[model samples]
Target: MPDIFFNFLACPLGSYCPLATLNRNTGICEPYSYQLPPGQPSHTCGGANIWSDVRSSSEVFCSAGSYCPTNTEKNHCSSGNYCPTGSTAEKRCFKLTSCNPNTASQNIHAYGAMLIAALATLLLIIYNCSDQIITVRERRLARSREAAAKVVKEKIQARARWKTAKEAAKKHAVELQGQFSRKFSRKRNITVSDKVTVLNEEYTDTDGNSYPSHEHSTSLVSKKSQSASEVEEIGSSPLMKMINEIEEQTFDSSESFSLEIKERNLKTKKAKGKAIHTHSQIFKYAYAQLEREKAQQQQNNNLTFSGVISMATNTDYKKRLVIEIGFTDLTVTLKGKKKHLLRSVNGKIMPGRITSVMGPSGAGKTTLLSALAGKTVGCTISGSILINGKSEPIRSYRKIVGFVPQDDIVHGNLTVEENLWFSARCRLSADLQKQDKVLIVERVIDFLGLQSVRGSLVGTVEKRGISGGQRKRVNVGLELVMEPSLLFLDEPTSGLDSSSSQLLLRALRREALEGVNICMVVHQPR
Candidate 1:
C-alpha cells in the first residue's frame, strides 16, 4: 500500500462517522488508509473529479477546484480563492488579496510633506519679524518713558515759577507800602507857599494833557495823588495782569494798567448783561410767567383756567395780576375749597388794560390777582378764566401770561444789562440770537432808565440798592424783554413815591396804547 496522508476537509457532511471512506477505483493508485494528525482526513471516499473525499464517511465533501458529479452537490468558495494552511490542511478558508505596500507608504509620505511645508513657513515668518517686533516694543517703551519724564519736568518747572512769582509779589508789596508812606509824608511836609508855586508851574498830566485852570489844576493834582495812592495800595508788580493770566510771567511795561481796567470794565459789562433779574418785579414777573406757563400747560391738556399776562418789546409795557374785592366775581374759579390763610383774600392786580390794581389793604386785591395769575396759594378757587377771549384753564394759559409780583426781583450781584440779557436768554426764543439779545438788552436798559446803572452791580446801588422806583421798572423791564403777549404786575408801584409810580404807570399806559396788554397791581398811586 502507498503511504497515506490526511487532509482536513471542510464540507457538508451528514451524520457522524469518525473517518472518511476511501475509493481505490483509480487505475494506478493502490488502496491506502492512514491518519497522520488528529482532525485530518483519513481517506478520500470517491471522485469522478478530484474532490469528493470527506473525513466523515456519511456525507460528501468537495473542493473548490472540483465539479460535483451531481448538479445539486456543487461547491465553490463565495468571496476569495481557497487556500489551505498548515493549521488547516484538510480544509480550506478564503483569503483576501493584499494591495501594493509601496502605495500606502506614498500616502503617509505625502501627509508628512504637507506638515513640513507648514512648519517651515511659520518658522521663516517668525525669524524674519522677530527683530522688528522687538525694536517696535522697545521704541514704544522709550516714548512712554520720555513722555513721563517731560510731564514731571513740566510739573517741577511750574512749581518753581509759581514760587518765584509769589516771592516777587511779596517783595513788591513791601516796596509799594514804603513808597506810599514816604509820598504821603513828603506831601504833608510841603509848605503852603511851595504848593502854590507847584500849582503855578506848567505841569503836564501822565496823559500829557495840560491843566485847563487853577480849579482844574487842583483837581488834576488831587487825581494824580489819588492815582499814586491807588498804585501803592495795589502794589508795584503786575499783580493785576497776573490775576488775568493763566500762567505767571514778567509784566510788560507797554501793557497799560488802563488796558487791564478797560478789560475789567468790559468783562463786568458782559457779566452784567448775563445777570438774572432778582428784583421784586422779576419775582412778580416770574410768578406771572409761572402762572401763564401753568395756564398754557393746562390748555395743552385741553383744560380751562385763567391767569395774568404781560407782553412787551423795545417799549415799556405793564400787565398786572391783581385781586381786589370784586375780582372773585370775574370769569375764573378754583377746583377745590379755599383756605383763607394760605391765600390772599383781598388785593388788586393791574395787568395791561387794567394796568393798575389800586386798592386798600384787606381788599382781597392781591388774592384776586393771584387767583387770576394761577398762583393763589393755599386758597380754594372756583370760577372760569378768560384769556385771549377764550375761557381756558389757567394751567393751559400760562405760556401767554407774563407776571411781575410786588417785590424786587433784581439780582443783587448782577448789573442792569446783565439782568435783561439773562431775561432774554431764559425765554429761549429761537428769534433771540446773540445780536437780537444785545439789542433787546440795550432796548430794555434804555426803556427802564437803567443805562447809567447798566454796569453797576445791583447790590451796590447807592440808594436802597437801586431806588424803589428803578427796581420796580426793572421788574417790569425783565418781563418786557421776552415780548410776552400778555403781562401782569402786582404792586408795581407799591414802594415808589407818587411821581415815580406815575412815571412807571405812564410808561405802562403808553405801551398799552400800542396794543400790548398792560396790567399793574398798585397799592397807592399819585
Candidate 2:
C-alpha cells in the first residue's frame, strides 16, 4: 500500500502523475489500469474518468513480459540529455533511478512540487504576450484592406466617367444633325460674310439712260460707308426727288435702276472681257451649294439646304479659324523698364500651318505672340495685324483668339473631369445645354489622352497628383475646349518628356489641319 502511494505521488523527473506508478527492483515508470468491478463488463464504459481508468489496465511503460526492461531495451537512464515533457513531440529517454516501496518518498514530493511551479510560470508568460502579437497582426491586415478598397474605388469612378462621356458624345451627334437639317432648309440664303452688299451696275445707251456714262460698275465697293443716315439722305435728296417727279427716273449710288428713252439712245462699245482665273473646284462647290439650296427650298417650303457647298459641309465654320495672320513692322517696348522686346519683327502666320517663334529664354518669342494675339494690354505694342486680308480690331477678334500662357493655373482640389467640365461651361455660350458642355469636355479629354486619369484629383506641390506632363496637357485642354479659331500656346512642351511632347505637338498640328492657325512660343526645337 505504501509502494502504491509512493509511486502515485512521484513522476518522471519528479513531475506529478496520477495515472502512472513506480516499479520496484528495476527503475521504470508504468501505467496502472483499473480492474473492472464485479459483474461489470469492461466493454461497458460509463463516466469519462472511469472509462480512462478502465483502459489503463491494458497498458504499461518500459515493462516487458513479467520483468522491467534493461537500460538498453528502455533506451536510457542517461546523463546530460534530458527528456522532453511536451504533450505531442518526440520524447527521449530520461535519467531515472530504481524504484522502492517506501524509500525517498519525501524527496520525490519536493521535486514534484518544483516541476509544477515551473510549468505554471511558463503558462503565465505565454498568456501575457498573446495580446500584443494579436494586435500587430490585426493592424497589418487592416492596412492591406484599406489599400485594396482604395484601388476598387478608383476603378469604379473611372467606369462612371467613361459612361458619362459616351452618352454625351451620342447626344452631341444628334444635336449636330438637327442643326444641319435646320440650316439647309433656308429660302433666302444668308451670306457667309456679314455686312456685305452686292450691287451689279450696267449701263444702257446714252439716250436710253441719259445718266452717268458707264457699261458696268466693276468696282467691288465704294469708299462710302453703308449707314442708316446715308440711306436716309440718298432717299430724301432734292435731286433724287426732282428726277423722280419729272423724268420718272431716280438714281442712288448704292441702288440699281433703269429708265427708257424713245428711239434716241446711244450705244456704248463693249470693253475686252478679262480672263477670269476661277478655280473649277471652288466654282463647282459654290454652284452645287446654290443648286442644293434651291432644291431644298422647293422641296421643304424654302426652309432647308442640301449637300453643303459642293462635296459636303464637313467643316464647322464657327469651330474653324481660317484667318491668315500677317504682321508688319511689329515692335514691343516695355515702358515701365524701358526694355525693347522685339525690334522690327515681321512675320506671317498662315492657315493650316504651325508657326513657331523660337529664341532663347530671355528673348522676345512670348512678346511677339502676345503682340500678334493682342494680349499685350499694358506694354507698348506697335504692329499691324491683318486677318484674312482684313485688319483685325483688338476688341472685336478677342473672343475668336485663344491664348494659353506659360504658367497655366488650375484648381488643385478638383478632379481632372471636374476641372475640364468647369472650363467648358465657362467658355461655352449660355444657350449651350449641360450635355453639350459635357460633350466638349469629353472631346478635350480624349484629344489630350486623359481618359485614364480623368477622375483623379489634380494634386499640387503640397499634395499628390498627376504627372507634370499630364498637368501641362490639362492646361492646353482648358483652352482647347473653347474651340477658338486662332490658338496661341506659350511653351506647351514645358516639363514634358519626349513622347508626351510629341503627342502634344501632334494635337496642335491636328488642330491646325482643321483650319486653326496655331502660333507657338517654344524654347526647344519643336
Q: Among these predicted structures, which one has the highest lDDT?
A: 2
RMSD (Cα, Å) of candidate 1? Answer: 29.7
- In model 1, the runs with Cα more than 4 Å from the true position are 1-352, 460-465
Q: What's model 2's lDDT at 317?
A: 26
Clashes of each: 103, 9
Q: What's model 1's lDDT at 476?
A: 83
Model 2 alpha-carbon drift over 4 Å, by segment? 1-321
Question: Candidate 1 on 1-526: residue-level lDDT in tens?
Answer: 2113223333333211223344335322222243234354553443222223344331333333332433234333222223211111122332223223111111245556778999999999999999699668756644543454455456657987987877677577557656756866675556444566665664544236755467866776786687667656655447444443422333542456326534644654564466444233222323333333334345434523321222223122223232222233343334464334223233333333555666678766666667777786545665445554456666664655678877778787776766777888887476543544544554456445665666565664554456556777787888878765567788777677776666566556545544556565665654
Cα lDDT, model 2, residue 400? 62
lDDT of 2 by residue, 1-526 (tens): 3334433432222122244333443323343333334464443322112111213432322321122232112332233223322111122332343323212111245557778999999889878988688667645544543354345456556887976875565456446545644654331133212214333122334446655423223232232333334545745766445434433222241133222211112211111122323233222222333333334335333323543332134332225647788888888988899778888887788877888878777787887887877778667977677778788665576666889999857678887877887878778778854434544665577567786788788998899899888999998988888877889999989789988888788678657756788888877874
When summed lDDT is taken over every stretch of 10 residues in candidate 2, the lowest stretch is 262-271
